[model samples]
Target: MMLDRVLRIVAAALIVGGTLTAHKSSAQDGAKIAAGEVVYNTYCATCHGDGLVSSGQTFDLRRLEAGARSRFENSVLGGKGQMPPWKGVLTSEEIDQLWHYIRDNAYQK
Candidate 1:
């Protein structure tokens, strides 16, 4: 009985660990990043730089952490520092995709 219980616990732990790993792996995608690049080129290229390397004020978004997504989204939508607000210009989903793209590729590494 103890053996069965141990096996069950191990199996459960493995399942949970696998699920978390999959979620982390699929959290970002290239297509979404491409779309975000388009959105950025169309809207934010002038100041932020199409290369995502402009070294002015405002935190470089490429290295933003997952925990900062909400605050960053609000900041992007509401405008902060020298960056303009984009609440009306872009949908929330699009903003998220852009953020994910930036997080995944834009000077982050």
Candidate 2:
């Protein structure tokens, strides 16, 4: 009976640890998202629209799905359609932050 109780406690601890690790891995850090938001407002909002809302004049950033990260990076860095390349204008870190901000506002999320 003592062994059974110990096993149950150990199992519970493992489950809780697994749950915490999963949550930490799945959720984007809030600080990174906030920093991304600042970068977006300063550099992207002019065309992407404020708060990621588009006026239908440009691509709606919120429409991008979770799997669109690579496309996002490519487009921003190389430019797409009428958008200008931001490769020289923004650092990779700033671009990553912008991605986080856009991800946070994504419709699928």
TM-scores for candidates 1 onward, in order: 0.65, 0.81
Ten-residue stretch with the least lDDT total in model 1: 100-109
- For candidate 2, write residues 1-109 as lDDT tens digits: 9999999999999999999988886565666799899999988889888898898999999998989889999999999999999899989988888888888888889
Best by lDDT: 2
Provide backbone clash counts, one per model: 0, 0
Deviation of model 2 at 52, angstroms: 0.9
lDDT of candidate 1 over 1-109, digit per residue (tens)? 9999999999999999999988876755666777888887888777777567668654666667767788888888999877889989999778867886777764433
Give the backbone clash total of model 2. Answer: 0
Flag clash pairs in model 2.
none
